[model samples]
Target chain A: MKNNIRVERAIHGISQQQLADSVGVSRQTINAIEKGRFVPSTVLAMKIARYFNKNVEMVFALEEGD
Target chain B: MKTSFLLPNKCKKLGKAIFVISAILGFYILFIEESYADGFLIFDSWQAVKNNIAIIGSLLGLALVAFSKERVEDELVMWLRADAMIKALWLSCVLVFLCALFLYGGIYFYYLSVAQYIVLLLYIFIFRYNMYKHIKNNEE
Candidate 1:
């Protein structure tokens, strides 16, 4: 799965730490998600999307191999 | 279950301290006596004690290190911990199965008592150490 977390963070002019705090996770989790090293659980995906005020699909998407 | 699953990251310092103490005691037991004239069986008493010390200390240290929270207890960090544990246990089971042929015979458990504990510690160390290295190296 691919995620637009980094791009979204940039768009919001927020640091990774800020986003992490907003979603109640650590910055490393966000970084891992952005790099595709960790896939968020459904609750976490919704939380992130909710933070960004975007649909879950807008924040996360399927890659060809995923 | 999750609430009691791990100690906070601040406890890693305690883990490190215990590891150092264990290492020191292990070495002390190993080298405190040497009977060149007695050959391998020279200090059998000390050797047994050393092995026991090694087993307990290593297990304690490995458990603390493996279960303690990371500096950042994010989903990925939790995942990594779980990943290391699963991988370690899988490899350990395979090794123990293979070694059990010799490690556990009838009832002569003490013959190679240290083998199982050492293998467990090695598995935990190898998996977690490499996983942590990967995480730190990939930090962007």
Candidate 2:
């Protein structure tokens, strides 16, 4: 899955650590998501979307051929 | 979507406590035992002390893990842990093979024993350090 988490976080000036703590996960997880090295679980994706007050579809989407 | 459960802090706490107690008991067994030589191989007083501590600690840890609430694990954290475990296993296996080769080449038994302990220590330290780094980096 491709996500706009990094861009969203940057717009809000929220660090990865801040987001991770809010979601009860390690910062490494956020970093991996931003780097496209990992895909977040549905729960985590929803948490991130909630934090940003955006729909999950707005933040995450399937890439072409994914 | 909110899950029906939260993080299992109790389990994590118990695991940490068990790890600390095990480390302290290990130190005593390694350095403070009277008749350390016998303690290493026989069921002597010091050996008994170590065994009891280990058994109790492990049981408690297992219980905590089994009974605790389920918590979500991030994919990245899981991957890092798996990677660290694989690396540690590989390193330990290589050390064991090297030790066997040395023994086959007629290295003295006493030196081989010391070497084996050193290798075990090194493996543990490396595994722990790598895991810590991974966790820290992710958190930063």
Candidate 3:
């Protein structure tokens, strides 16, 4: 899956650590997600989307390869 | 995001400390105890020391669990736990097979002992590294 999480976070001027804390995850998880090294579970993805006040589809999308 | 699943920094710090203490005790037992053997025997001085270490380690581990702040759901915790168990199972099976081959080839007892220790160390290293990576990667 590909996501615009980094861009969204940057636009909101929110650090990854802050976002991670808000969502109850470690900063490393946010880093991994931004780096495309990990895929969050459904619940986590939803939580991220909720934190951004965006729909899940807007934040995360399945790539053609996926 | 939920904060419930993540271990607090204090808990992580305690866990690391416990692991280091346990490792040190293990090394002491392995190197300083002359009567230590692969098989179990009646209680002795070495066994007494080992028992004390085991009890202390278990207490530390339990304390960590008791003091944890974040209450992650069991299901989510199971994901990482299952991964670790799978890794351990695979590694242990391979080590056992290799040990069998060595035995069949008439390797010395010392060689077998060293091999077992190396395998045990490797297993611990791999498990700890994987767990750390998993936790680090998943931090919010």
i-RMS for every candidate:
2.4, 3.1, 4.6
Instruction: List candidate 1 segments past 4 Å from native.
Output: A64-66, B1-3, B30-58, B97-113, B130-134
Model 2 spans with C-alpha error above 4 angstroms: A63-66, B1-75, B104-127, B131-140
Given candidate 3, what's the lDDT at residue B114?
Answer: 43
The CAPRI quality class of candidate 1 comes to: acceptable
Candidate 3: stretches off by over 4 Å:
B1-84, B104-123, B131-140
Ranking by DockQ: 2, 1, 3
How does model 2 score on DockQ? Answer: 0.46
RMSD of 1: 6.1
Model 1 chain A: weakest 10-residue lDDT segment is A23-32
Task: For candidate 1, write residues B74-127 as lDDT tens digits.
Answer: 666666656666777777677667666655563445334445455446555765
DockQ of each: 0.45, 0.46, 0.28
Query: lDDT per residue, candidate 3, B1-140, as tens digits?
Result: 33354456478468657756865765566556544544344354667667456436645643453334433322234454446557766877787777677665435554453453443344345545765776666665
Best by lDDT: 1
Q: Cα lDDT for residue B103, model 1? A: 58
User: Which digits, one per residue and each the tens of the lDDT, describe model 2 over residues B13-96?
Assistant: 776577567656655654465323435433567566665565456455534443344244555545544565577578777877
